[model samples]
Target chain A: MPTHNRIDATKVGDVTVVTFTDKKILDEAGIQELGAELFSLIERDNRRSIVLNFDNVDFLSSAALGKLITLDRKVKQAQGRLKMCRIKPEILEVFQVTKLNKVFDIRDEQDEAIAAF
Target chain B: MTEQSDADVWRRVIDLPSERGSNREVTDDLLTQLKVFGWPPSDVFAVHLAVEEAIVNAIVHGNKLDPAKRVHVECEVSADRVLVSITDEGPGFDPARVPDCTAEERLEAPGGRGVMLMKSFMTRIEYNAKGNSVVLEKRRT
Candidate 1:
């Protein structure tokens, strides 16, 4: 598959940070890769805290939102936490509409998100 | 292929041939134009999200990321609504088989919510299998 969507993951203390630089996250194949990467990162690090930084993303589809929710569930099962930050207001509204804001701890800035962990 | 004043409400239909690297800029331009029209932030976001999902699906799945195949997108704006249609080159799939996004087990799977989001935000969604197209309508309300 084409690597049109890029994702980078790193560890911040006990927290795992995944940054997506893709212009958009759509399609079945890309979403599968995203879910796999996130799950592996969590399982490998056993981190209770995870931060998804969408500072560079301008759009996110419901499929991508589903992945976030799924990852959140995984984190909880592992006794960890999931947080999201730097979401654009446009993208943030999607979360609000879907009521995902209640599921994930959202912060306004990356620093605040990391601090929340 | 026509130019109008920046302030004019613009509308057109373009063939989204599967020439892919990234069509993000094109999608961005459309959203920007809609934003300029004073589309409420939520509605704007919904339209952008829906368009991106539809276009990306066309580029990736429908056209198999083939630069040779084409996807067609049409946009129309009246005083109260925005209507867009996206058509792809692939054989197409059955919309009936799409699992419900709200289902508990399928909640975390990436990439199954395009139809769901379109249905949720758009006032009307019509799938034309004969044309391999999906039409979306969003009202100003």
Candidate 2:
């Protein structure tokens, strides 16, 4: 996949770890870019395990959450697993409030997330 | 107009075209102004996210992304309070009709979570009678 400014992708064992470069992923443009990039990444990569690292991101809008949902769906369609790790408390609150916590496999650490895959 | 007391709140009202990019511009402007007014980083993030959700709702859901339509944004900032109102030009929907995204059946749904986040972060949230306009407020402790 082509390089993306909003996120960085790296490989750890069988997992493709995607990390957001921005601390705030609330902007519409950035959110759109992230969704497109992640979609492209999932399509191109044949890997079945994906770990989304939220360590750098501090706050994200509902739009960003929507993008994550989209990514989760794409991963599921690819017959792969998706896990989110290192989410801040405030950001986690959003996931909890939306009840996405139940739908997603979220972990307090990256190792745990990657291991789950 | 008469001179106002320092205690009086200052307000800025902006007219925005129903464009996606305007969300970033408005969010940056409001965060910058709030930071200068001595709001902490966390509070700034709360207001920023709340406003982004409101604006996106207005432009995308409310205005249906019609360039011909417009969104009116009003921001009132006082020493200890921040009030923002966003109005869109589309036909309104019933707020109660919005499904509960937190429910198990709706968890994976792609939409309908914006209002939940807005209500979670802001101190108070109110929708106008027409349901096309939403007001969000945060009062500093």
For every candidate, give the share of true A-B contacts it also has. 0.43, 0.75
Using alpha carbons, what is the TM-score of model 1?
A: 0.70
* Candidate 1: residue pairs that collide: A48-A80, A48-A81, B16-B71, B17-B70
What CA root-mean-square deviation does each model show from the true structure?
A: 5.0, 2.8
lDDT of 1 by residue, A2-43 (tens): 232357767777676778967667655677788877877667
**A14 Cα displacement, candidate 1 (Å):** 4.4
User: Best DockQ goes to which candidate?
Assistant: 2
Q: What does TM-score give for chain A of every model?
A: 0.89, 0.95
Best by lDDT: 2
Candidate 1, which CAPRI tier? acceptable
Q: Please identify model 1 stretches exceeding 4 Å from their true place.
A: A1-46, A53-58, A66-79, A85-93, A96-117, B1-8, B129-131
Enumerate the chain B TM-scores of all models. Answer: 0.85, 0.89
Error of 2 at A6 (Å): 3.1
The sequence of per-residue lDDT tens digits that candidate 2 reaches over residues B1-141 is: 121224456667778888887766656767777876788877887788789888888999999989999999888877689999999998987888889988878887788888888888899999989999998999875
